[model samples]
Target: MPAVAPTLPDDLREDPRYYLRHFQFVLDWVAAHHDSLLAESEWKFIVGFGELPEVSQALLVRMVSRKGELFRLSRLDYAEIGDSDRALVPLVEAGMVIRDPLIGLDELFAQLRVPELRQCFAERLAAHGIAKSATRQRLLDVIQEYEEAGDAEPQRRRLSHWWTETTDQLVQLTVMPVCDRLRLMFFGNLHQTWSDFVLAELGLVRYQQVDLGELSHAFQCRGDVDLYLALHDLRGRLDEGESIEALLTEIPPPAQDNPWLAERRARLLYRLGQQAQRDGDIPLALHCYGLAGPGEARIRRLRLLERQGEYAEAHRLALEAQASPCGEAEQQGLERLLPRLARKLELPRPELPPTRQPRARVLELPADHLVICGSVELAVRDAISHSDRPAWYVENGLITGLFGLLCWEVVFAPLPGAFFHPFQHGPADLRRDDFVARRRRLFDTALARLDDGSYRDVILDHRQRCAGLANPFVHWELLEPELLSLALDCIPAMDLRCMFQRLLLDPAVNRSGLPDLVQFLPGERPSYRLIEVKAPGDRLQDNQRRWLDWLGRHHISVEVWHVEWRHD
Candidate 1:
């Protein structure tokens, strides 16, 4: 008798409709990218990798990382992604990190007793010309001891020595008002906390001994534009009820006839409109949203109209927002998002409580953390200012978000698009060399458009305009070119709720086989991929048996992954 085919693999066992060898596909994906990856470019590189097909994304992680690491990705990591849904639990449980799960900087130092980690700091300091002082060693020891046992002695010693040290006690300030260009320059990308002391004394900003969060918040509350993470506190205050209008009032708009500046003015008008909307002023909210986008503005007005049971206009604009674009994925996403919104309009809305904002709280921030944020902001800014290529800033938060932007900017200089100048295109265009430099070029352009009174897509495009959220993975930069978000032709309007269909796949393909747990992908196809997302612990839902079941039914394949298992 002819030799029977070897029993299909366990995962492929009981295959009814389809068959695909995922293991082999993963092997080829990783070998291609891992060896070529550069450390400095790691972040962008990682995000770019996501552009691969789903099977390829899943397969690449498994092939590039050890089996054990791949297993952990299935279970423990990528638990708190803010947007995209699919959970990566199984992979994490299979492979775990040896190190303690990530905690804050202080908690990390206070918890782990890895002598190797201490040695690493010692070695890094020596290499970077940061001498290992006896005081430094003492501090390290105290912190390390506290890690093993939360003895107050360690913290007390840390505090006493920190206060006595004169190392980070000086600061200096130089300001350049961004009249025409909104150019915010930090004298240096990296400043020690000591430098801040001098600035504080010079009255540039108030200094506080409290955590950086409070100090930053206080700065924002004070109405000073600080491009550092510390400004978050100020943001919170502003979010609550702080006012910075007085400070802004001092700097009058330039008399020059620049369209960009006009756009900026329009943005303020839109903001006021939002305030009115929150105040339950339906007509006013519609006006602001309209300034945001005529169609967009009308749509918002329609929401209010719909809420008041004005179905006629509400129904009309819902169709308008979903209007088809020649070839724009964003428009399509909006179009797809439209029906859900329309359905919502048909439903009754409840009376929402009045928005209550607080005054910006005042707090003293430690000098060290401020220095970190300043360094990152300055580096990226300087890089863009210095580069000949069209450069721009890409950031998430307005002021407090400067730190991360700075880090990425230092590595990626000259921001893209030579200064958000009267450009005709979006920042996703990476053909230019200064692609990374404009880490925030997207937002800057939006601001420019708003200032110019031509901000058509501002409200709907906030996510892309913000550019903050998209920078999480290294590979996303590379992935941008292939994203369905930008191209309408590449995506299909499928509710992400029931199933995730690959745009590349045609649903009408012949369905010949019976249903079994294992779905067959075209065996000859090389579409395997992997996605390694780093997120908080809650990213994966504990009740995911249903999703897994749904996923198990789909013919196209994927592996949602957690990154913890790889690096550690």
Candidate 2:
């Protein structure tokens, strides 16, 4: 059975307390669909929260949506919730908020302004022979030194103890961790916050609605949720400059069942390895890269080995990667690495495959040409454009936009772990390895329109229907009606099919590296040619070179135009 969708109020702006309503909606939705996944404590909190007063709920929601877990009562004044003190009473009684909790010195420094600090620590500052007008950092340092040097216990105190004059209390929301778990379940990631609801309510951002089934949960089991939370914590620690060795030990082993979780784990390991390498911990970097999942990790490990003078191991890994590379980037890296490794070991030099060089031409334009056009690519486009053939500086936008429109349904299909939330720009697994394999039939059906004459109409209808909708591939701002129509008329469906097939092969990598501009030759038999622009001393990147080579093999007209400033 499909899960019942949350019915939002028709006019959110009419209600000043809309955020409270949105929070209630999420709780009800999670309780209905994901009750089995919730812990006993979480279930209790959810049930108890529903029984709280409206103002209390609003206050709690506000805290959860705010930046920090601890908030000063004076700072939390909201006209919508009549009196924060009254709202906080019910929250404190319900054990959802901690009042006057012990806070560290660092947190105290953050909570109080410099004037407040001076007022509170005036006697201590004078006794320590520090000036009253000292900066906040200087004051904190002197106080910390005095506290550490003395026998008094570490300076942990309640807000009242820090500032006795004011009655303002500091309260910490105890349910923030639980709320974060619920949020992760709803959004499948922590990056999206409560602001998404507000943005959607105000019609600032839009999303495609997909019907979610009873089984359409982001996590399959409790272990998946736990692993995800662990990873989230580890990433936070990593960002805070936590010890790499300690974090490495804390990362959970790769999940064998969930590819999504495993991929995240691999990415974390890759990041940790990069940090370790930058820190000059060669052995740790090698250890991390060796254990990481398939991708640049293997190539990174090879590079580290070669650098450490382990030529034999590097050569073996290079050969293994040569047999089946992770992606074009790694393959390109290996092509350069193998010959060097062979020479280092004094072995037979490996003969690398011949690479295709893009067809190049030079144009010496006046220096003012760039100033007038605002960019080298635009200047070159204007230089070569003719009445018969029009050009636009659409690097990767046009082709990707067309592909997105043509395959809208397939991309947004209601698959497990893909469309769990309403605020998603695209499917969660759009860049995953099995993204295409999971919906092979749907993609094939969508692509079949190209073979027939139905592709043009289908794409046009989608462009009309889904205009302004957020999509990962579609650059809606770039897809003007006339440009889209011209593309539909000029670019052959076979060529689109080829480009889309390449995109499906690896969406993460292939989505980029397209030509900087495209020129359309409109006529009875409309045709187009892709152009890549380069300024003086600028050269094509490996990805761009790969695209040019692939386009040439497919008989697509592409050129590399190098621009040089004219001296005369």
Candidate 3:
């Protein structure tokens, strides 16, 4: 007979449909009774863990207690763990043994410390045609074979599933709740955001310590937690309308000694300096940044120095920083700062073109160009469909539709490491280089198609595919083969290619702001006009201006049709 599962308390048990909710319940119980459940020694170990040396902490976090009461670790994983056997002594003395049986990967590898045994395992793994790249799988396969050869040890059964089971299944057999164990297992670890959530859930760390930003790792030192908390206190005081002078007297600067803390120290000081500068205390702002070491802090200091009329110091600093090995963005910041500093220092600046006055160009509506004046976008689209010239009225679909047809593979499969992240699941960084790199292959395909005269076929295929797909950018009925063929023949290949390249360079800005409507003329030679309709009070946005500028530069025929309401 199958054994019955043990019953849990009503508070602990959850409905079958909401089984995953039980993890939250189990976490709540462990948190409530943590002090009572663990012995005094274990409690001390958990709370005082951060005080240990960073290397020791790194080792413990990499280890996970297996279902068989043994901790699983791999020699290959040690480089990232950043520790040696000496680091394990303290945990071992505390009765937290990291071990497995003879057939286990860690234990077997330990015994394999004997030269002969190492050669035997390597030979066996290799005899099975396993390359060095498949080392982990090879080890597991050899271990299984050894187990089957009459090694009747009871703990051997757990070894079979140890290397292959899910984390949740492995944690289910452990004494502690998965969440509590995970917190202890990953405390103060960098590179993964899950550890941040675990610490935050236990209330041991604040959310701001692990806040997502342009930089990958947020917390770099033990003192970072303290700095985050202190900043919170100062912000609270400021929100209550406290004076900057009064708050400055109340909070002391953070005293962090670890060299790893340099970046965090610099960032926090820069932020405080910004706050002080806004409060009209320029000296205090400079002082805060002075204590923080260089990197980005120097840039902030340069800006503040310029504001204080210290042109000589700012110019000298900018020149010094420009000579250093800096990232693309920091170099660009220094470039922009140097020009402003030059003008302030009474130095000659580069001569620029004559400033052209920006004006709204009025155009007489052509008989072929159709305008539908509706209070809303949807109403305008509906009205245009009923006109003489066949028109597909849209907000920002035309250019993107053209792009999707030209580069279908890239539109679907974004480049690895550029957009899709295994952990974060959000687009990692949409910077220009990353955006261009991810779509380079697609751009090449577009170029090849243009050269081979096969672009018409590609456009036709994409139009068909876009019609079947429920994509927002593509309206199938509007992108009929006849319409796409006309566009292919009428638009110059080089002009279209340049425009698309500009669009890919800054996708977030250029993807939108396309002309609102694409209307095709009723001629055998496929002629078309793009009209951007604006209601009376509506002006063009910056992105719209950029699109119009690119069109004007290429001498493409585009019109801005401004519409006004007429009352009887």
TM-score of each: 0.25, 0.94, 0.41
Tens digits of per-residue lDDT for model 1, 1-568: 1122112243433332111232222122222222232233332333444444443334333323222121222232321231111322222222211111323335333422345334535544454454444354554655465445755443422211323322211111111111100111111111222233234334444311211111111111111222222222333443565434422233234224332333334444455555667767666567555555433344445556666776656666656655542122223234434565556656533232222221111222333433453543233223333222221222211111221222232222333222211111122223222333344454344334434533324322432443523232122232232222221121111212123121111111111111111111123331221111212242433113223333345422323332221221
Model 3 per-residue lDDT tens digits across residues 279-353: 888898887666554655677788889888999998887888877824433554676688898897788773432
Quote model 2's TM-score.
Answer: 0.94
Residue 376 lDDT (model 1): 31
TM-score of predicted structure 3: 0.41
lDDT, candidate 2, equals: 0.88
Question: Best candidate per TM-score, number?
Answer: 2
Candidate 1 ranges beyond 4 A from true positions:
1-271, 294-301, 324-416, 419-556, 559-568
Error of model 3, residue 323, in angstroms: 12
**Which regions in candidate 2 have their CA more than 4 angstroms from the true location?**
1-5, 124-134, 151-153, 349-353, 368-374, 385-387, 566-568
